[model samples]
Target: MNIKKIMHVENLTHFYGNQIGCKGINFDLYKGEILGIVGESGSGKSTLLKCLSGEISPSAGKINISLDQGGVKDFLSLPEQEKRQLMRSMWGIVHQNPRDGLNLRISAGGNIAERLLNVSEKNYSFLRNTGKYWMEKTEMDSDRIDEFPLSFSGGMQQRLQISKILSSNPQIVFMDEPTGGLDVSVQAKILDTIKSIVRDINVTMIIVTHDLAVVRFLTDKLLVMKDGIVVETGLTDRVLDDPQHSYTQLLTSSILQV
Candidate 1:
């Protein structure tokens, strides 16, 4: 059985006034695969994720989506309410800044349960138990889950963000540098936690990061970009070891050799 493409984009183009965002963007994310996007700072990796996650709309082209519910829909053209429903339950996004994405004053449990409340809130014990379970799944202490987000370390907060998003059980995950600016050891541990958790649930993920090490560890397919256009895309091992494009070779070389 062929896994229908969960997400699809064709000839996607965007603009901020006269500035080009990305043109001719095309890709398909299959079920249960980690698709990694890597590019320089201004290369539109973040922009593309935003588009896919419905945070922003593209200026042109179509985003066709096949929901698990047996409904086929076009993303770029949807009623605002329908879009909201899709985003709230079907798509999980972890922005680059953990602080920007989460409510800092809310207890970590509240943050995770926020989306869970969307379905049904009649059972309080079950909600709390689910939240507590994910905190442990993220390797976070259950005792600290009731603490405010501001009280946790940066890495811990990122895990909270993941837990919050995952609690909703989105079919597609859009993660922007979920493990950046942390100490190497912490980054490794966080990646390990993410890898384990996402795999166990068989979730589809698209992570945009400049870190090649992250790409190697978290993804099977690699998409490389520069100046808002994809230069190369292939299996992770091939793209990293024997890149076909100059930009991809440069990116592969930039990684710290083991």
Candidate 2:
């Protein structure tokens, strides 16, 4: 893939009062690339997502995003309404739990169609057609489109959550622990499903995960975090196969040991 920075962060810092979550993080996410973040808990992985998404503004630094309009803007400096609009159509965040991402009361298709409702200058027919197209693309059977999220298995629910976000066609997708809490076999399937979707659609992804094995399966590049800081980052193969930073080496070693 031709490499260019889709999102750039420089001098990035996040603080909760006196305690820092992540400090001076500089990185770039390329188009059609899967960037993995691997770190132990409390390593500021989730905090970075919050900062980037504008859910909680960063204490300091610049986040520049290339807009579809052929312009760039500081995502951190945007007005509240503008940021909210950006999130509704341009960006997506998938939580660790499928249930957390989906509405239990709604059918799978309703959950997938929520994005269209948020920006519905279009008619009802457009939304319905779009929903069914995405459902089929995500490997969801047509009959199950009307089923409640509660009725699906964990893996199925996760696929539905994926379908929900992909239907919006976000420029970037940030996933927090995409395979957490599932057994090894189920986790692998989830990872494979996600990889297939991203490859098919060519969306950039930033995945924060504790599981290095999943990272290997899903990401093209990597960033290793330690104590609210980025210790290292590079091509996934380079970092895992031959890490330079001590902390990164330690992380890869532990994963290899397992």
Show pairs that collide, candidate 2: none
What's the TM-score of each model vs. the native? Answer: 0.96, 0.94
How high is the CA lDDT of each candidate model? 0.87, 0.85
C-alpha lDDT (0 to 100) for residue 4 of candidate 1: 68
> What is the per-residue lDDT of model 2 for residues 1-258, given as tens digits with 9 covering 90 to 100?
566677999988999999989899889877888888889999999988889888898889999998878677888888899988877778888888999888999988788888878777367677777778887776777678788999988877887888888888898998988778778787887777787888888999999999888888889999899999988889999998999999888887875552
Q: Judged by lDDT, which candidate is best?
A: 1
TM-score quality measure for candidate 1: 0.96
